[model samples]
Target: MDRQFEAGPRVAAVICAAGAGSRAGRAEPKQFREIGGEAMLTSAVRLFLDHPRVGHLNVVIGAGQRARYDAAVAGFSDPRLGAPSIGGATRQASVRAGLAALDAEAPDIVLVHDAARPFASTGLIDRAIEAALRDGGAVPAAPVTDTICVAAADGSRGETFDRAALRALQTPQAFRYADLVAAHARAEAEGRDDFTDDGALYAWAGGRVALFEGEARNIKLTTQDQFDDDLLRRAGRAFLAQGDVRTGSGFDVHAFGPGDHVMLGGVRVPHAFGLMGHSDADVALHALTDAVLGALGDGDIGAHFPPSDAAWKGADSAQFLADACRRVREAGGAVAHLDLTVIGESPKVGPHREAIRARIAEIAGVAIGRVGVKATTTESLGFAGRREGLAALASATIRLPFRDEDGL
Candidate 1:
């Protein structure tokens, strides 16, 4: 419930995602597509949900999209987000449906946005709200930079005009709650549902519309080329730039015990003996769990799941690593990479290296490429050389929102 803005009028947002976006060149709608390691819808919802001014929000979805929507926002909880509003065939209708859903709460201001455009920044939202409060309506727009042209029926240029007065309008358009409701009502009554955006509808209904600055990077993903590896990398960097990077290291040792298999990185490798620990003696995962916690400065694994607690007796260590990853997410961060080195002599790690890496990646909810597993021997100088125990060293790299020096 912590926010960064001063309190004002109650703000709500309608995220329009009901359209069957065939142009995005995907089987599913573009809003359900993956962007920056998450669904486009999730990114958009998180943007408005995290804003201080927004008190209520609703997502308008097409029929039969409930399952996809649930999976995209799985584990996310916020009182501001209500049930999904059933949308009509058109974007205008979909937005109206969302607006109608919010009629019960009747927020002071409403910002209508496209779920496809997930990169809109908080500053842009601030400008839109400010303009809406000053004027009656606001639209985020960018100046047209390309040469003006007119296309004819035969695909020929008809006219060339000056581009100075041209502007490319974007979404997250802001308007007074009552004014927008009245505008939509008028449009529906007149059987006019052709308005592509709310700003135009409001304007046609005699509402004053003002323009505000828009970010160049606030793009609506609409093509397959936009999902290219290189483009996504740049987009990920832009998204992650708001956070600071951190790295932490951890080490753990577990002696041998009587068992048929040993758990390493959540994988059971057949061995003559297993590692000894309070839980499933997963040395690799325990070290990784500690490394992740260390990066967040949230203490080690023992602090969160104490050994004295009988509840964790014989528990799966994968849950420990999963919990650590959850904490990072709750703190508004993401795991960038994880590296683990197993030091042992008995259970040869080479044969199960790929499995260990895959298991760790699955447990951490990251790509397999982001998880690295390596094995080394102690050269007959330590307990690992004598095959008395197994040891692991791990490092975790994470990205977190920038905190003031004193804030930590």
Candidate 2:
């Protein structure tokens, strides 16, 4: 069979192996269990460490499993995979700690993966990484093949959910290192500790997240029945040389009317008149915010932050955009790149382009290089040309960190 490959940016893999795996009924943690000829965690770690693009590796092991994990990795002399560290109480905590354990020379991107999913394939990892590089953050997720029933707390079925809208999220969730670090710090400080995954914590912190199709073969070894060496090995070999990528587009506009100031990329840009709207009339920010939200299949800005509420009567536009970006990032996605074009002859985009990009970078918690800003004139043609007010258009490319067998 012909082999296929996809290129992606530098990434760090942070394996969460701190869980006890009590559900698996194993003498040792499932991550330490042998899948084929190697420990599960070791197998998973080897995947990313072997990848050429993977620049750093951090393994978060349970406090007591350090010695055993160390022994398991002793044979793999990859300097990129740093020495393991003790994980925290919860999975989120473990991820945060694992990210912290990365060497001072951390990679530009980070992929947080579940060590128990020993069957995760390199193709899935490549797809996730490609998604992240294009969209900002990425995660491996399989469609909910089984019928989904939404049950009430009283043990009664409330309603059946749309299978098309359902997905069984899986790991190797990836993100930009700096954004992930900041998000974790923010969530920790805010005392929001109820997340079941890193992506959830990221969303709560207002980061954009993107999703990639995951292979059903890459099953999490959560149950004894699901543990099969043959299946894992088969899946691994089949996807050893495959990869994928996806792209999305977003655009938003608001007419100029009245307000104190116009918000652009989460920064207040001085203007003669504020754009008219419920929230702060930041045409640029709104456009950017919608672009991100739209890409994630999340509702538009109005649906998220409604104008119906009086609280947002004159709220800051930057906050709205920041919050939206937070949702995206928390979903294991990153703002790969964003290009915004402000329309209108007044308030020249030339002088403010760099400032707008900087502000956007700050809002999305991404490097300035990943954000772009430019301006164009209507050539005195339409509404913008008439100078009735100013308008803006934005396109965003986001990336999701993906977990690959080769830690690239």
Candidate 3:
């Protein structure tokens, strides 16, 4: 008899273990501290290794803790797990280093998690990966159920804040590999180091960050009291070990008809004639929009924002693309990954790729790492060779909740 089988998505796990954990008052980093008969790092690594969607793993450890983390994780080894790399002084720096250590070949997605969050559930990781693959940047987060406060430094009460609008962020934040690399490069070049987490970095780099409801049990073990095996087990109770993955493709074209400027992927390219259309007619944005819409099973750009409607006349194509992404989210589907290619002859895509990716991420409501925008030429073969027009292609993946849950 034949057997039935199901496959999960492929994702690379990047575990950040470089924090000193001074607040925990431990000689060893909190990630390396013993928890439930094993080092915290061991438990954390095991979570990803055992996860069905996890295809590759890389650990970023403090320079001195490399050997310790290696030894701790040795017994749980698998081909998916890569060797540990020495990390930098800051969390962002450590992430950059960890990303650099990724195998030369790319994976479908990359999950950047903190080893300190030992209680992170496999379900949460799967959900995050699903969201990242669908929405561009998916992060595990819990809504703030309690009343919030804006307090003074001395602990004196100040203004009470609205909890409804607040969310407590957590991790195993996942991104598409190309988007993450580009965001890191932009941040590093801009000399920014203030990001508290990878998601923040993505947001700072103009990438959209979508929030997924996180399990209360999936807490980061920042202090001794936060480390409880029973709590972790309880948190994993509602978690399912399964995951899903899908891919979609997008294509767009704009002819050089008449205008002073050409818009490609939301960036203005100086030219004699612009792509003529109802909107700004950016081929890149249209392709990406179609890709995202396709992943969500939502109809294409024309279906959502019709050219027949004058409201979109000469409107920024970037916003139109973004609105399409918003509709996808409202429908309970999340964008996980996106890859885009721009084909043009005159206005070079290489010089504007990063900016274009950033714009697309912003419009699609995803982190920069979840969006990939590249450029190429047809070697002057078709109308593009005569500088007559530009074209673009894009692909996207999305995750939808099993039953249309409200928060996730």
Candidate 4:
């Protein structure tokens, strides 16, 4: 160790998942595909995000992968998670890209792991960080169990190699930040991109390499069968048992107030009068927010953004819906779908249905297809029929964890 290790060294986690994973034989890319009822990349990212030693996480992904990546990481809120960086053609290039993403605030240590391997435990993470501090560069490796043999070009055994000297490497490889960065730079300059892992790059750069114990069960998912196994194990967890299918409904009405436009599903539409309330009074979003709260057994919008608070005056209703979505995610659940109906005589919704759906999807962090919006009048029977006020009815379907006592 050339430099004295910091007593509290800041460690960053880098997840390399840029590969297309064609070998997995799945319709979607392996990382984005579900393993434990969640995206494989999401599970992998969460493991480190939950680790106390990791101060930051930078996930490297391929081009055009941002949308799905955002969906995978939507629920977690942590300052340690950085924006996704675009990766290059190869694994080494992708890792370099991730490292470059952290150049502005390089931590004392970095743990680079593959996204395909979702089972790296917290204990392993601690070991890697400790090993990096003590050994300069260290990788987790499992001892070889099978007999080893050197093969000839034509598939003939040339000679038997010693099994005692063999070990299979795994990720969560830890390295001193500056040393790893410099080694990668050297590899790039030398046009030596053949190294498969960072440890090899470190060794090629004439840096000392150390090995730490690795898990045999921390296997990477390379095929669909492995993915199925992952999901099976995930199902075995008590928290993942099926039961909670909650549906919540919300209704909101705002009388015609003097304004030039009104907000609906985060989109603004010209109207003779705007909805009046503590916030922008986006009736559709307010209804949807309440519906989400109802599904969560949480209180309505007023309880969250009380009208008594002056800060909420003239606030954008999208914030309320976003807050509701965040709550749902934090509770280890998701809003499966949203259906909204607009009850009004003016400011027709037909012209802006697609726009409104897209806006709601954006605010709720859900797919546009999952959002349904419709418009209908009260047939000239009540206040809505007389065009005195506008009302919205919304329903939210959410999936929540089933507790032992709350079984169906």
Judged by TM-score, which candidate is best?
A: 1
Q: Tens digit of lDDT per residue, candidate 4, span 1-408?
A: 366585989899899988898888865789988765789898888877756568899999999889989999998888889999999988899999999999887699999999999876655776799899999999999888888887999999888878889898999999999999999999999998888899999998988889998888678888766667556786666444434779999999999889999898888999988888888989999999999999999999999999999999999999999999999989888788999999989889999887688678768866565789999998998999998889999999998888777644
Query: What is the Cα-based TM-score of model 3?
Result: 0.54
For all candidates, the clash counts are: 0, 38, 16, 0
lDDT of each: 0.87, 0.74, 0.77, 0.87
Q: Candidate 1 — worst ten consecutive residues by lDDT sum?
A: 1-10
What ranking emerges by TM-score with the best candidate at the front?
Answer: 1, 4, 3, 2
Residue 287 lDDT in model 4? 96
Report the lDDT tens digits of candidate 1 across residue range 1-408: 111233568789999989888887778888998876789999888877656567888999999999999987785788888999989989899999999999998777889999999878766777788788778688999988899889988999989878899888998999988889999999999999999999999999988789999878788888788777788888677656646889999899999989999999998999999788999989999999999999989999999999999989999999999999999989888898999999988799998887687678768876565789999999877888999999999999999877687375
Summarize candidate 2's per-residue lDDT along 139-244 as a digit string, tens digits: 7778888888988999998889899988888898877777788888998898976688877877777777888888786778888656556776775554442232
Tens-place lDDT digits, model 3, residues 330-351: 8656677778888877787676
True-structure RMSD, every candidate:
17.6, 16.3, 14.5, 15.3
Q: How close is candidate 2 to the true structure, as a TM-score?
A: 0.53
lDDT over C-alpha atoms for residue 134 of model 3: 72
